[model samples]
Target: MSTKLKSVPNDFDSIEVQPLSDIIGAEIRGVDLSKDLSPAALDAVHQVWLQHSVIVLRDQRLSDGDLVRFSKHFGVLDFGPNMAWQPEANRDHPEIFVISNVVENGNPIGFLGDTEVDWHTDLCHTDLPPKASTLYAMEIPTDGSGNTGYMNMYTLLDALPDDLRIRLDGLQLKHEDAHTLQGELRYGLNEGDLKTIEDAPGPVHPLIRTHPETGRKCLYLGRQWNGEHRATFVDGMSRAESDALLDEIWTVARKEDCAWYHEWQAGDFVMWDNRCVMHRRGPFPSEMRRIMHRTQIRDTAKPF
Candidate 1:
C-alpha cells in the first residue's frame, strides 16, 4: 500500500473513502460533485485517488460542465481527437467525449460502439499521454454487460519474474499511433501509407516508467495485439524478440487476480490514473444501450 494512503489525514469531514477491492479502486461517499467543494475535501479525494489508482463516486448527476469543472481540479483537460463518426457529437462541450452503443439518424452517436475494448492506456501513442481519465455513466444496459476492468500496474510489475523484471529495466517501447483501441485505423491516416511496423508513426516511451509524483516504477506496455501491424514493439530489439517478451508480460498482466471490474450504475463516476493502470471493457448486447461521458487529464511532462 502507498504510504500516503495509509497516512491519510483525518481532517476530512465531508466524505468517506472505502476500498472496493484489495487491488484497486475506492468508493468515495458523501459528496455531490455538481456543487463546489472545499479545498480540503478535494485534497482528500485527490490523495485517495493517487493511492487507490481508481476511484468511484456513485449516485450523483452532473452536466458536461460539471464533469469538466471537477476534472480541471486535477489537471489540464485533454479533448481527444474527434472520431470518424459523429464529429459534431461534442460540439457543446468538446472536452467531454462520448462513449456509447447508440445509433441515431443512421449514424453512431459516439465512439467504441458496444464491443469489448481491449486493455490499454489512453492515447499512449502520443508524445505525452493523458495523466488520467474520468468516465460518468449516463445509461447502462440492464442485462449486466459492459463492465469495465482495471489492472494495477504497480502490483503487476512486482509480480513479474525476478529475471524478467531486471531484464525489462531501462527498455523502451514504440507505440503505434495509427490504430484505435477498437482496431480501426485512426482518422486522416491511410492504411497504404505504412507498409511495415517500422514505418508506423508514433512516440517511443520507456517500457518501465516512474510515476512523476510518487516516483514508483511501473510497466508501461502501451498496447499489443496480433495482426499485420505490430501495435507496439520494444526499442533496440527485433520484432520477433519484442513479441516473445511481450507475450510473457501480457500473460502475467491478464491474470484474473490482478484486476477488478466495475459494474455500471446509471449515476456512477469513475476516475483512473492512466500512468499506472490499464483498463478494458466487456462487450454488451447489441440491442442494449450504454452511454458514457468521458474526460482526459493531460500530463504536464512526457513519459521519461
Candidate 2:
C-alpha cells in the first residue's frame, strides 16, 4: 500500500517560524498581534510552539483583553495569583498583571525593581502551576539591560548523566512560597520547616515531570531562595544530601549554553512553556522606564 503526503494549506504560507537558537526559542514572523488569528493561523502557532517551546512575535501591540484572549486559545486562562494589584491594572483588568519599573504620582506601578530576578517558573509555589506564561512588552529600556533569559529543561534533563537521571527518577520537589512575580509575599504565609516536603510552605511535584501532550520529561526545578520559604530539599532526602545534589544539577543546568536571552522591544510578545522552562531577567537602570503585561495559562493535566 502507498500513502500520499498531506498537502500544506495555502494560508500556512503567510506565517514564518524561525529558530532563534539550537535548543529553544523561535521567532514567528508575519503575524499581527492586534487582530484575532484565524483558525489556520492558530493551529500553525500551536504546532510551532510545541516544537520550539518558546515563540516570539515582534512589532505588534495588544491590550489587556487582547493578550488575555490570545492566551486562552492555548489553555485555560490563569488570571494570575490573587493579591494586591496596581490601581491602574486593578481598575478594570485584574486578569492582566503589570511588570513595570515605572512609578506615577508616588506610587510604583508594578513589581521587580531594577535588579536581577532569579530563575523560577511562574506559580510553582501553588498546588497547580500554570502551564505557560505570555509576556507582552509595552516599554523597555533602550539599553536592553532587562533581557529575559530562558533555560530549556528538556535538554537540561537530557544532558544529565545517566546516573543522575536514574537517581532523580521519582523524586518530587517541595516548592515553597516565594514572593509573587510582583515580588510580594502571599498573605498569611510563614517561613517554616522547609526541610520536610510535607512541611514546606507550598506544593510538592515530581522533579522530573512528563509533559501531558508530548510525553517528554523535563526537569521541574524552581528557585533556590526568595521569600519566607524556599525549595529546601527533595522528598525523602536529608538536607545535606539534597543540597549537594541540587548544587551539582544547577552547575550544569544553569550553564550559558543551556539558555537563550531575549532583549525586549516595545512591541515584542513572548509565550513560553512554564512547565518545561525556567526563566529569569537581567538587572536594568532604575531611572529608565520598562513596562510589560503578562498573562499565565492554568494547568489542566497533572504532572506525572
Candidate 3:
C-alpha cells in the first residue's frame, strides 16, 4: 500500500474511499459534490484523489456551478478547447463542456458525437495542460455503451520493459494539436496552428514525465494516434523510426492489464488526474443518448 494513502487518522470524518479496481479507481462515498464541503472534508477528498488517480462519486446531482466549485478545490479551472465546441444551450457556461450525442430539431446537442474517443490526456495539445478533469454523467445509454476507460500511467511506466524504458529516457514528444478525441478538426481551428495532422498545434512534452507532486515517473504518450496517422512523435527520431517505436509503445500501453473501464450511471461523477492517467471512451450507438458535463482544473507545474 502507498504510504500516501495509509495512516489516516481515525477522526478522518465520515468519509470512505474504497478501491474500485486493483490499479486505477476509487469510489468516494459519503460526500455530495453538489454542496460546499467543510475544510476537513475537502482536504480528505483531495488527498484521496491524489492517492488514487481516478475517483468516482456515484449519484451526484451537480449543476454547472456546483461542478466548477467542486473542481476548483484542487486547482484553478480552465475553459479548455472543448468549450468552444459546446452547443448554444451550454454556451453560457463555458466551464462546462457538454458531451453528448443527442440531436434535437435537426442539430446535435453536444460533443464527442457517439464515436470511440481514443486514448488521450485532456488538453495535451495546449502549452499548459489541465491538471485534472471532472465529468458528471447526466444521462447514459440503457445498454452498456460509451464506457470510459482509464489507464494507470504510474504503474504502466513502472512495469515498462527495461529496453523501452532506457529508450524513452531523456526523450520528448510533441503531442498532436488535439482537434477532437476522434481526431477531427475542432471548431474554428482550421485556420490556426491546428490546420493539418502533419503541421498541427500541439505542445512538446517529456516522453517520461516526473509527477510534480509525487516525484513518480510515468510514460506520457498523449494521444499517440489519430485515425491511421501518427498524432505524436518522439523528438529527435526519424519519422519511420518514431512510428516504429510508437507502434511498439502502443503495443504495451494499450494492453488491458493497466486499464479500468467505467460503466456509466446517471449522476455518476468522476474526476481523474490528467497528469498521471490517460483515458478513452468506447464506441456507442448513434441512436442511444449519453450526456455529460465536464470541467477541467488548470495546470500549475509543467511536466519534467
What RMSD, rounded to one decimal, does every model reach? 3.1, 4.4, 3.5
Pairs with backbone N, CA or C atoms under 3 Å apart (clashes), candidate 3? 177-201
**By lDDT, highest first, what's the ranking?**
1, 3, 2
Clashing pairs in 2: none
Q: What's the lDDT of the predicted structure labeled candidate 3?
A: 0.81
Displacement of residue 119 (Cα, Å) in model 3 is 0.6
Candidate closest to the true structure, highest TM-score: 1
TM-score, cand. 1:
0.92
lDDT of 2 by residue, 180-257 (tens): 554455566554623354564677789999988778999988775442233546878887788788887887876756
Shift of residue 91 alpha carbon in model 1, Å: 2.7
Which residue runs does candidate 2 get wrong by more than 4 Å? 1-12, 80-90, 178-186, 190-198, 226-230
Question: What lDDT score goes with residue 296 in model 2?
Answer: 80
- What's the true lDDT of residue 161 in model 3? 85
- The 10-residue segment of model 3 with minimum total lDDT is 1-10
Q: TM-score of each candidate? A: 0.92, 0.88, 0.88
> Per-residue lDDT for 1-304 in model 3, tens only?
3222333344344677788889899888777887778777777778788888999999988888899888888888876345333444545566777788988777776777887888888778778888998999999999998999999999888777889888888988987775665756666765466554446767789988988877788888888444356678777887788888888788888786899998999999999999999999988988898999898888887778
